[model samples]
Target: MEISTRRLKLLAILGYFLTGITGGVIIYGSEKMIVATKTPILIFMVWSGLVLVIVSLIGIYGVIKINFGYTVLSSFALVVVSITLINHLMYAIIKDRSEVESDRKVLKLWNRHMLMGRAMHKIQDRLDCCGIYGFQDYILNDKQVPVSCVSEELVSYIYKQLGCKEASLREYLFSRNFIIFSEFTSLLLNMITAVAGFKLCSRIDRGI
Candidate 1:
């Protein structure tokens, strides 16, 4: 019985450590886009990571104290985390699927929406990319290529030849894959933590 308790405690601690790492991964994946895009999904991703870390901390504390109430709370928190992660995962998949189709739409709306234009400029500047497909996108659209497309040196060779479309898409795909990986990892850990938590709660209740 003592051995079982020790094992359960160890499992909970390990889960907590992994969960913290998973949360950090998710946060790191989305942090940059949060300010640039101001998208709700990115904000939610950040919040989800924070919540997971907090819940894992609570779970670790519960396991250490052998407190049934805290253990139960942690189990419930896992359910919430699972739901959020599922939602986040689905959104990411959908966005990934539609990304190619959305390129033209983005280009069309580039000059129309002030917010989108600023966001595109920011992305171009940060990625050292030009218009959607290339600088020719501006030419084709009869629009002037912004200064963001070029380096400070203003040399022709230094000008960004890559398009913001490809650059941003590549970045988004990488972030999406990273977040998906973290979410799956977190969900798996959540299950382990939930099972271990419940069993520990039961053992504590039985005074074992």
Candidate 2:
């Protein structure tokens, strides 16, 4: 395809602008949400989103080239952030439900994971897992569950109930969490990639 030099510059500039804007919005929203909510999860989102926004900004100047390094880090960032987000997001939205049957079903496995994880922890307070930096010593059962080692039995039951035909307990626990988040994160990922692809396509459209 024949290309024009000026259009290529425009495409690159547009990529820089769009990513920068998205990153900015996420960063600002995260900061606001952090202050507004005392909940552990919201605090976690602020922290995660802060990091993600930073990475996204890296794309602004040089996402296309190998030297950018943004592409390398983004994959790891998205996967980790997505899992944490899904579990907590689900918990937050489900809080109002009166343990109703449909609602309970949606929540049961996730709740069990947290409960059994807490029981396994069996500690007062030290490290906050997946929430925020530094451990807050106050325990809230009505407070959030502490980070802990989950029991094997709890893992197995969750796996079986979730329709696992194969019975590897390890597969159920760690992998299941990934499976739960993979779908939601894919949506976010598509949004990101779509924006990126658009920037690239725009170059072609303009004869860049």
Candidate 3:
């Protein structure tokens, strides 16, 4: 809603501190693993992620002292985190589907709809509304169901979360706002976190 400058600064500081701690842990763990395992790719990753984390940390200071600077930076940081979070969520959905049924309990009634087509068909019979597969994509009088349970959920989640109030997944995907800022904030935060962490970890690439 409406947050004052002071509130924003406080939020920024908390966000920065947590991000920094996590990034620090990642860097430390990676360093030790890199040294012990001698994995080239992993080593490089440590440095790259470290850099992003540090930049994010600096964004915190900028936000607190430099006025709206941190807000701008924090938006970017949010983007970064959003991207990674979306990626992970996708991965989870895929993983869940591959190993077991995609109908996780957490997904609620949606779970029953995915695994058992018959059950979904029955649900359609009960409700005047169209058949719900994941959240949207209702089976109409004439429509073919697509495969990929994980993809179904992913699209559905995005569509419902960012979609028009009444629009289905089909319509939500086409929303201009979703396309533009779908994951913008997350990408920014990811970059910020990485940059700040790298800056903080001086001994990373240079071997200090």
Candidates by lDDT, descending order:
1, 3, 2
RMSD of each: 3.4, 15.4, 16.3
Cα lDDT tens digits, model 1, 1-208, are: 3447889879877887788778887777689765434355667878988888888888888888888898889878987788878887887887665365336535654665234445467667766777777877767866666778776665766567887667666665666676778789899998888877787888889998
In candidate 1, stretches whose alpha carbon ends up further than 4 angstroms from where it belongs are: 1-3, 35-40, 87-91, 94-96, 100-105, 112-119, 139-144, 152-156
Candidate 2 lDDT by residue in tens digits, 22-73: 4455446545433322234435544655654564555433435533245434
The runs of at least 3 residues in candidate 2 whose Cα sits more than 4 Å from the true structure, single-residue gaps closed, are 1-20, 33-36, 96-208
Q: What is the lDDT of residue 66 in candidate 3?
A: 52
When summed lDDT is taken over every stretch of 10 residues in candidate 3, the lowest stretch is: 97-106
| TM-score top scorer | 1
lDDT head-to-head 1 vs 3, winner: 1
Candidate 3 residue runs with Cα over 4 Å from true position: 1-3, 81-208
Candidate 3 positional error at 180, Å: 28
Go through the candidates in order and give each one's C-alpha lDDT. 0.74, 0.40, 0.43
